[model samples]
Target: MITNDAMTVQDQRTSKIILAIAAITILLATFAGKMPSGMIGALGIMVITGFILNYIGDRTPIINQFFGGGAIVVIFGSAYLFHSSIFPASAEQNVTTFMKSGGFLAFYVASLVTGSIFGMDTQTLKKAALKYIPVILGSAFFACLFTGLVGMLVSKSFYDSVMLIALPIMGGGMGAGAVPLVEIMSGKTGMNAETLMSQMVPALAIGNAIAIVMAGLLNKLGQVAPNLTGNGQLIRGQKAIEEEDQSTAPLNVTTLGVGALLAVTMYFVGTLLSSVIDMHTYALMILSIALIKVSGIMPTALEQAAHSWYKFVVGNLTPALLVGIGVAYTDLNQILAALSPMYFLLVLITVLGAVFGAGLIGWMMGFYPIEAAITGGLCMANMGGTGDVAVLAASKRMELMPFAQISSRIGGAFMLILATMVVQAIA
Candidate 1:
């Protein structure tokens, strides 16, 4: 029989071989003309770059110590490659096309949203949902106010500060956050939606970068001050221990399929509702999953199945998802163009405001400050689904992803309405 250590060594060797083969394939495809352009090529390049950047970032002494280890590296590295034209226009287009048009992000999000909701303890879901909105509000209030103050001191107006810098940063992600807000601003300001969005994209990107780095710092704070964190839980004393990963369910191909099916179904239901109400599918999906989880309509066997599926997806797909994000969404040129000293300072202040506001309010409400800030504040400030994953991973509190989703989806929706009001009041 193979000893555990021997088996572990074998797995490592297998992983190395896989990485080597992936790298070799990408190198050949980059130079050669016959590389496929759809999912196959996209997956190949992302795997190659994601693994390499992730490995290097994690091994580097200072980068790994505080700046979200590989998470920051993957995003910035990918952005640099794309900006420098090293990613080959063909490969870049191929990857971007697959991620957006082929529905890979939607599919990935469907599983995470569904499995996370269903895997939680129902009571925790029910109770936490009641007070979480306050946490979101706290994050936004501070982020906006502080950003507005900075704007006044700079050449920009308070309105410009709030809408241009603060709103986009907290809005959610690209599609769910900025796109919809652009529509509202177009109507309110009579500027073209695309034009308005162009001005705001840099803020979202930089805010997301700051949020990811802060997540790592917040994790360190929690470690130094154990009293400030409930590990991954938001609320204290009400089943705060994370239950999503505590599945005793049998792991098999069949059960994983069942889990995937359940997640897809929930996403479909959310999409169906979106036809009637103008909201992001993710928000609707969260509500639907929470309702079912709280109502006890789902069976124990099925819950466990979902948990196992969530575990599997988060473990295997996260790195690839980050790669896709870097390839499809991150734009180093856009970020660099917006990176004047004043611009960076404004965005940094917005993110800091979010952390402090959320952390202070969370502490008042008996929630751990570190957990609250990471989930409520950084999650809002980040780029939406992709940003949430990166920030939470940096904090090493991925079990808090359900809360992070709530902050992103629900909080993002709230930002749209607030943006409309801000436009009406100031514009």
Candidate 2:
């Protein structure tokens, strides 16, 4: 009979050889400028790269401690990798298309949203929905106020700073937040949208990077000061937290399929409702899910299945999704180009202001300060859905995804309306 220890050694050797072969293949394709194309090629590369970089980030000294560990590496590392000349341009385009047009990001987020909301206590869901918006409002108020003051001191243009820089940075991502704001400003000020976009994109990029870093720092803070954070729970001293079922049900393939169906169907419903309503599709989806949970309409087995499917996606696909985000959304070049002492300072203050405002208000409403700052503040400051994923991943608080989506979708819409009013007032 073969010894167990010898068998283990042989298995390890086989794994190493396989990894080495894969690495060599990737290198050869890179130098030859002949990376495979289409979904198969793009997804394969992203998954391999994500896993390798994630491993390195987790093992590296100091990086795993202060930074976001593997999460940061998978994102920023992939950003640099995709942007470098050594990487094939065709490959980059393929990855981008797969991430956006393929609906991979939406699929990932819908699963998280549905699962997290369904898994929560019904009463907790009700209380969080009622109080979360106020936290977002608080975050926006402080972020704008701080950015405006600093802009006046540095550039002597408070209106420009508040309108151009602060609003866009806190308004969500480029498409939903900055684009609409620019068009509204164009109508009021007679300036071209292109010119306004040029001015705002840098701030948005830098702000997103800052928010990601802050998320990592906040995660470290939670480790040192557990009292300030509720771990993943937003509410403090809630019975829901105490009563959470620690023993999860065994994995059921059929149940997971049912969960996937429910999640996608809910997203479809959101899309339909959005066509008739003025709200964003994501916002409508969140509201619909929350209502379903509150109404006790969904069966217990289905809810558990949704939660189970969520766990599976987060475990297996998160690194791959981060790779996609790095390739599609993160623009390190833009961030570097916009870096100045004064500009960096203003962006940092704006993010900090958001954290402070949300934390303070959330505490008053019986939510944990760190959790509130992350979901309510950083989510708003980041680059919308992609940013939400990166920030939440860095913070190691994927369970709070439902709240993060609320900040991005609903809060983003509010910023658009606020921008319209501000433009009408100033113009």
Candidate 3:
């Protein structure tokens, strides 16, 4: 009982206990047809549970890590298991009903507004924007161009399939951009939008699982790869960046609040403009950024809001989206069974291509290995949406979380514009 391994044993026991509690609670809720708000309650529980576990873990490192990982596995694994059992009755109907419920629209609007308001700077923020605006704009432009070209070559039908694949990637990875793309393709091509979306819901869930595994593997690879480079020269730039970051002032609450407000304002403004101008969402995003910058409001507010918004989107909204998907899981075997091979192939190609390309480009740009990997994820998410990017972004330990946020927003805006233009051209 007093052995050195006692702690390990206790940790395992604690993890199992938490997992069991979660599994049972989820099962009861799901089976009783009482799963609250289309898995919204479930997602909230997961987050709250995760936070509790994390807090407990902080006190006991071994237990913390064990339960942290175990809790997630249990929650998701159990949800999937429970969902599968009850899926036969009305998967199609359930998913369609949820989609039409407009949960996603609300989530998107909230995220956009919150992100815009929180993304802005409060103090001397405008100056920061002037400094970083070019870099952000340039990145967005290229990312859009790249995503558009690739999305076009892949075929409209393929785009539809990729959208499906992108969803799970987003759900698990926090990639939101994929959903809109899927919707756009469905609307433009007269495809079976609901059926396609239903097929994607499961794919996204699977993608989320895969993204977790991939993130771990990539993180390991990043750690080991740097060792191969000559001693000293390998991480000079990275070290320099880190040192530079350390010297900068830390973000404060008022600044953060102001940023959130600005991001929120921008979201509504952008939405309004989109409805009136009939332009692509990405175009609207870029226009919003431009207006915010030129309005003498200081780009920093947007930047800060963007940062806060990213956290909120990833931590809160993203999980809610997943729950939405879970609620939509009614069991549509017949529809999924009818999916063409081309559709599957297109999805696989687009995801792999985007991931690989983003990584390569990030690496070429001299970004840290983790940053590069995130960039790859962002590329996929941006091309697809937030769900995919969040998955990729989550894979790495970032030195600066804000960079990932800005990169995602900028990249997504660019991709949206590019995708829309491509669709328009083909039409």
lDDT winner between 1 and 3, please give it.
1
Clashes of 3: 52
Give me the candidate number with maximum TM-score: 2
In TM-score terms, candidate 2 sits at 0.94
Q: Could you tell me the TM-score of candidate 3? A: 0.50
Q: Local error of candidate 2 at 85, Å?
A: 2.0
lDDT of 1 by residue, 101-124 (tens): 988778887887777777777767
Candidate 1 TM-score, C-alpha based: 0.91
Each candidate: what lDDT? Answer: 0.83, 0.89, 0.44
Model 1 scores worst on lDDT over the 10 consecutive residues at 238-247
Task: Please give, for residues 1-427, the per-residue lDDT of candidate 3 as tens digits.
Answer: 4776998898899998997787677546645666565435445444443344333433554322322232233334334533565422333234334544644533443454344323333222233334333333433334334433555676754344334453333322223455665566677766776775666655544443444344444544555686422111112244443233223333567655665565556556767887988654444654566555447565443455455545555554443343333344222343355356554444444345444554554445444434444434533333233333323333423222333344455555455555566566665
Candidate 1 or 2, higher lDDT?
2
Best by lDDT: 2
For model 2, where is the 10-residue window of minimal lDDT?
Answer: 241-250
The best-first sequence of candidates by TM-score reads: 2, 1, 3
List model 2 lDDT by residue over 1-427, tens digit each. 8899999999999999998898779757755767777777778778888899899998988778878889999999999998895577877888899999989899999999998888888888888889889999999999999988989889648888888888898898898999999999999999888989988999899989889888988899999999999888899976456246413634788978988998899899899999999888888999999999999988878888888888889998999899999999988989999898888888888899889989999999899999999999999999999999999999999989999999998888888999999889889
Residue 291, model 2: Cα distance from true site in angstroms: 0.8
